[model samples]
Target: MAPISIRNNPDRLRYEVLDGDLAIGQAAYVDDGEGRRIFYHTVIDEDYGGQGLAGRLAAQALDETVAAGLMIVPVCPYIKNYLGKHTQYADNIQKPTPALLTVLNNALARRTRR
Candidate 1:
């Protein structure tokens, strides 16, 4: 089995999960520019399914976001559901707001334009 690693790729506004040197999954988010990371989506390649990579990715991303003194805004259903079962991040979670959704939407639109 290949080793797994997770990293924040701020340039791309996402956290990438790697199997050795290959990217196998990603959790996408946008910084609200106000101490919040609005997570919008997460996915693992079908080939790598059933390995718990999504959980690992969520844990690492949420951990790092808290460590950085940022709040988590889980717009993605997976992330929201993960938080429902994990209380550690309860204090750091911010419910999604319309303004935050705008932030995420604008960021995604900009990315698509590029």
Candidate 2:
């Protein structure tokens, strides 16, 4: 099996999951510019689904966000779900403000193509 790689794609506001040069999944987020990031989506191609990549994506996304000294506002069900099962990242989690919720929802709406 090829090793999986994940990294932030700032221009796209996503943490891209790569499998040996193949783009397999992504964890999407929006930065609030106030030292917090609102993560709203975690998706893997159906072909890649069921392989636990989504969990890896969530971990790496949260890990990178923490490394950047930012907090997390989980607006995505997938991410929220992931965090629920991983208490270690609880320190970085925060409740989203109404304004942040609006921004998160709109960013999610824009990703309909995904």
Candidate 3:
């Protein structure tokens, strides 16, 4: 397997992972001055799914956000659940509004059902 590489594609508004020559996963976000309010998605190629690549991608994205002095709005369910399990990241979390939480939940549900 090729080592995981996390890259920031400002034009795409997200961080992505390249596993060897393959694009294994991505964490999309939106940047507002207050912080990088992350949302929408993460998808690991089926071949890479069981290797914890998604978590690694999330960790890298979080690290980048912190390095940039930005907080996180984990509008993406993977991120919310990650923060839930990894309380250490709570410091960077920007509290979510109910509507936002609803949207995240819905996205998660949709993804899960697929």
Candidate 4:
């Protein structure tokens, strides 16, 4: 299998698959006063679902966020679950707040659009 490529699109706050030419996963975030607060809403296309693409994307996103020194707010159910299983990323997780939830919801809406 070809290696997966994750590219961060700052304009859309999403990390996409460059090799597959497919948007295998994405995360949403908002610029808070301190830093970017990421909320992952990742989805692997059905054809790619079982291949560990989502995890890879999420891991890359977390890695990038850490590199940038940004905190995260994992509002996406998948992300929440994934993080629950991956304690190593806990330090990067930001505590969720009402405002952050609003931001996450809005970002998700934008992502659903064409």
Please give the ranking of all candidate structures by TM-score, highest first, separated by commas.
1, 2, 4, 3
**Highest-lDDT candidate:** 1
Error of 1 at 14 (Å): 0.9
- The lDDT per prediction is 0.94, 0.87, 0.75, 0.74
lDDT of each residue in 24-88, candidate 1, tens digit only:
89999999888999999999999999989899999999999999999999999999999999999
Candidate 1 Cα misplacement greater than 4 A, ranges: none
**Compared with the true structure, what per-residue lDDT tens digits does model 3 show for residues 68-105?**
88878876788888878888877878877776666556
Q: Which segments of candidate 2 are over 4 A away from where they belong?
A: 105-114
- Worst 10 contiguous positions by lDDT, candidate 2: 105-114
Candidate 2 lDDT tens digits, 1-114:
589888889988999999888878988889878899998878898987788889888988898899999999998899988899999989999988899898777776776757
Model 3: pairs clashing at backbone N, Cα or C within 3 Å:
none
Off by over 4 Å in 4: 1-3, 105-114
User: Candidate 2 at 38: error in angstroms?
Assistant: 0.5
Cα lDDT of candidate 1 equals: 0.94
User: Mind giving the per-residue lDDT tens digits that candidate 4 earns over 31-70?
Assistant: 5546766565677667666877778877888888888888
Candidate 1 residue pairs in clash (backbone atoms < 3 Å): none
